[model samples]
Target: MFFSFVLCCLCLSVYADTDAVKSVSVMEGDSVSLESNIPEIHQNYIIKWTFGHPENRIAQINKEAGIFETYNDVLDGRFRDRLKLDHQTGSLTITNTTGTDSGDYQITIIGGKKITYRFSVTVYAPLPVPIIIRDSSHCSSSSLSSSSSSSCSLLCSAVNVGHVTLSWYKGNSLLSSISVSDLSISLSLPLEVEHQDKNTYSCVINNPIRNQTTHLDFSQLCQPCAIRGCDSAEAVIRLVVTVLVGSAAAAAVAVLVYDIRIRKAELETIQTSHRPCTHCS
Candidate 1:
């Protein structure tokens, strides 16, 4: 009978350990509130709160003993001013969340036995206003021809953005994107030569917390003079000239060496003929 009792106790302990509640979610701005249903077995237990992925206990409340303990090192400063414990409900509230406040959190209960609960918190900041700047040098479409291509780039500026996504759009469709703490830049794309009369480009910056956009008209973009097959022809002509000059130089050097060798041979034959013949009678 004693053996059976020990077995049942062991089973109960295992079940209690697995019954701990855990919840995690992202909170907006600088505050977060969490609530969980407490089991009857946990009524007499002490609730402990912790931060980090594995849930290191940072603060605790002893319900029966009416005692509270906190670890300042584990709790972030931004959370320190805003962290509050509801002793009655065993819930946790955090305010004034900052970028550094994003992380995992946990709650542990200590009573006749020990039970643990865990949660994760994420904080977000709003997107900043986007600024549009014209890039005239790279914005020229007239520089492009049937045999040539031209590129144009535009600048988008913003500030104080946190975890926000930036994108470029032509109408409702996305074109390109670049992310920055304050702004989002767009990459240079091919501009239509005929579309220079139309204004149809914009920058879109967004985050879960906020969003902003900037627009560009055709006049703000670059327009270069169009030349028919000028770029390709110029490149081909330059290459051909380089090759021809190199070949001419080589031919000139070969001709000079050949002339020098022929002259040396002729002089040697003339000297030999001018020498007195030993067999002359």
Candidate 2:
């Protein structure tokens, strides 16, 4: 009995290996197909497909009865008008896939032999092209690291992205990267390069299936020209302050001269009065 039990366990393990679950991935708004992996289907065979739970039957086919149907009204009609079944291989296809469409799917076939297949589907939204912008937070003139202004600080951002990696590449080399698995989250990465870097650089956002990239324009976002705006703003403020100071000084000088003239006139009148006027004499 023990020998028989061991043999049964081995057989089950072999079957499990043969029926291992498959993973499928597709971009949102795209179509994806699932294969039954069955070479041929004989007459009187029945094939059934389900999603999430086995009770949620999505598609089915009965060869003997000549019946092929899809449950478009099931599961809140999430699969309405989006399910397709292959008459030959019993494969299933879903059109205009979305992130909500990702889940576990099962297939059961009954003929001379019973067979099962499981699938895990994932649908990712198209990746947003990473945006590279100058990062002045740590690159201002007051920054100790920016005193010489030898390098430029930059940031790469991807907004509303899910299941992706954001990376900075320098001349086909990865400088830095960060990965995210949450749904529709914003992420950013930082990079620093020489102000006059001649090597090419790119920011890329990618998921398992697709990627989007944006090239860096050295003169457009780097140092030297990058901080000119900040510097120009400071220069304008200084110019205004200098003009105001000059005007105030000029006004003060005018007031002093007027006071001196008034005092001199008063003194002259006093001296004339004290001298005993010629008319009085």
Candidate 3:
């Protein structure tokens, strides 16, 4: 009996790894068709498609009667509306897939012998637009040198991502990339870049189905002087001079307002003094 049990386990392992098993990946809200390894179905054969464990059947086909049925309450859910079975080939199609639909799917074909085919289906959400932030939190103008001024640091981040890659790119060239194989988590990548005008940098977040890139314009983010072809020191001096000139103008205006107020008060006093003939009249 032990030997028989061991043989059964081996056979099951072999079946699990058979070429009959297929792996499929799809984006959320998309449709996927899981083709049966069996090229042809006989009238006498019964085809069943199941999810998770073998007994949790989701769909079944009766070739002789040319009918397919989807079970409700199998996992307290139903695939009847979105599930389709190709009776001739015993293939299954699921439409408008969701992340919850990712799991092991198995098909059992019972004819003169029972054959099982499995599929590993994965559904991924569309990646959101990654955020690119310039890290000026630690940078200072007083500590900056020519070499330090030529470069800038930035961070790219995405939230609640799984089985995807977050990559940093300078034009078409890849600079860095990171991925977490299993659990969904917030991911981030830091990048240091030497300022260059001709090439644009970008952060790309992608899965198998879709990708989004956030483009970086260096002239806008890094060098304020490079945009105008002016010296950085000259730009600072010009800014200081502009502020001083504005302050001086404001002070001069204040003095003129004070002088006007004083002259009006003096004119009122002179008019009052000249009109003191009220008692005499």
Q: Which stretches of candidate 2 lie over 4 Å from their true place?
A: 1-19, 143-148, 225-227, 231-281
| Preferred candidate (lDDT higher): 1 or 3 | 3
To one decimal, what is the Cα RMSD in angstroms of model 1 from the true structure? Answer: 11.9
True-structure lDDT of candidate 3: 0.78
lDDT of 2: 0.82
The Cα error of candidate 1 at residue 54, in Å, is: 8.0
Per the 3 Å backbone cut-off, how many clashing residue pairs does candidate 1 have?
7
Which 10 successive residues of model 3 have the least lDDT summed? 224-233
Summarize candidate 3's per-residue lDDT along 1-281 as a digit string, tens digits.
56654554444445454455577999989999998666566666788888986458888888788767877667657564788888667889999998888999988877656778888999998788999876664244543644565667788999988898999997899999998767569999998777665777899999877899999867556663244333455657889999999999999999999999999999999998888575574
CA lDDT, every model vs. true structure: 0.60, 0.82, 0.78
Query: Please, what are the lDDT tens digits per residue for candidate 1 over residues 24-77?
Result: 434356567665345232335667777776666766887667775655555444
Q: Which residue runs of candidate 3 sit more than 4 Å off their true CA positions?
A: 1-20, 78-80, 145-147, 224-281
TM-score of each: 0.52, 0.75, 0.69
lDDT of prediction 1: 0.60
Comparing 2 and 3 on lDDT, the stronger one: 2
Error of 2 at 249 (Å): 26
lDDT of 1 at 273: 86
Q: Ten consecutive residues with minimal summed lDDT in candidate 1?
A: 183-192
